[model samples]
Target: MELDFILSKEEKGPSGKTELIYDLAIIGGGPAGMTAAVYAARKKINTLLISKDLGGQVLWTTEVENYMGYQYIEGRQLMDKFKEQVRHFPIDQEIGEEIEKLDKGEKFFSRNSDGEIS
Candidate 1:
């Protein structure tokens, strides 16, 4: 299943059949997940990030002050910046997809919509 990432123009893929493969597959889009995406891109890895939404717990909070580079920032605003930074890389992302299950595998995850890994 060579599904297209909506925000990206590149048709190149790490997707086919019932599963997709990447040098890295990040399972969230929170501060940590987005940050991992950035690092993976820098390392030139074929990466995928699957998330229900961006920001995770950070988005619900009213303010952010602990993150580096900003003494004070709104949670939503911080997430926006993270999203923007992720756009600059060749990363595959699936948004608004809630994962019901995931399991350990050789590459880490081998998943199906029905929550099976094969």
Candidate 2:
């Protein structure tokens, strides 16, 4: 797993607008969301990860048995691993934020809890 590029926080054009364009936007920081981010990054896709927190339902479990490679691992520990893997990539993150609205047309846009549209 090797990537040849490191992306800036946002892509700016000659006019210097701070708007960011992503090839993919993943909502949630759970196992599924984190997994998607990893895959997207591996493909060199510009990605955005939005979530209120890192762990989801899996955080409530005391032990996980069916998660491959580990016979028995703590919920938090598993989530930590997922987080680590996700951080290894240059995926954009919006943790602790929630999407309020989403619009689709010529381009897709979303408004987060802070009222800032992206």
Candidate 3:
């Protein structure tokens, strides 16, 4: 059965199936995840970023002092910059949704919080 959800525009294959493939799938939108996305994009890899929301624990931080390039920056501001950098690349994002399950086989299959697979 086909899932009703469309993860991304490139998800549908010639057979009309949601067969999107990616060289990397970052499960969170935290500082680490965002960094990984940027690196993967720089490497010209087909990448997907899935997260309930961006920023992660960093969003809760009031001030960011160790984030390089800036002596001090607000957490939100830092996250915004990260978001902007990630968006500048050709990376696929699935934000505002949580992954309910991940099945590993010849390929990885992920089910979102809404029970939709992509």
Candidate 4:
């Protein structure tokens, strides 16, 4: 069955102002992190997914057969499906940077590489 929902444009808050703290902060964009983003965003919880790459190890695989849907599918194809699902929600995705540390506060802070704090 096909499902439909409105996808609202992400609203930009004040510049440099941290908003509400997320219920969860996922630090990888493999299958696990992507899945978590899908679930948390659906539940209307503030969620942030930080990863250097979106697909992670899954992007390197050429073929996957044990995933239970098709007998076989290209690894990139599978990752694409995951990414499509993730785009449906307001999950925050930061790419191309490694997470150095996580600071818990009213609004969580994630420090990226290059010593350029965020």
**TM-score ranking from best to worst?**
3, 2, 4, 1
Candidate 1 or 4, higher lDDT? 4
Stretches of candidate 2 off by over 4 Å are 1-16, 113-118
Name the lDDT value of residue 92 in candidate 4. Answer: 73
TM-score-better candidate, 3 vs 4: 3
Q: Compared with the true structure, what per-residue lDDT tens digits does model 4 show for residues 8-58?
A: 224334575433445566789999999988998998877778789999898
Candidate 1 Cα RMSD (Å): 6.1
RMSD of each: 6.1, 5.9, 4.7, 7.7
* Residue pairs clashing, model 1: 1-16, 1-17
> Least lDDT summed over 10 consecutive residues: which range in candidate 2?
1-10
What digit string (tens of lDDT, one per residue) describes model 2 on residues 12-112?
54467655656677888999999999999999888888888998888999999978999999999999999988889989888888877777645566778
Model 3 CA deviation exceeding 4 Å by range: 1-18, 114-118
lDDT by candidate, in order shown? 0.73, 0.78, 0.79, 0.74
Q: Compute the lDDT of residue 25 as modeled in candidate 2.
A: 79
Which tens-of-lDDT digit does each residue in 10-114 have in candidate 1? Answer: 433345423444556677789899999999899877788888898899899899887789999999999999899999998888887666665553334435566
TM-score of 1: 0.71
* RMSD, candidate 3, Å: 4.7
The 10-residue segment of model 4 with minimum total lDDT is 1-10
Where in model 1 is the C-alpha error above 4 Å? 1-20, 104-118
- Model 3, 1-118: lDDT tens digits are 1222323334655578667666677888999999999998898877888899999998999998966799999999999999999989998888887887887655467788788875
List clash counts for every candidate, in order.
Answer: 2, 0, 0, 0
Model 2 global lDDT (CA atoms, 0 to 1): 0.78
lDDT comparison, 2 vs 4, better candidate: 2
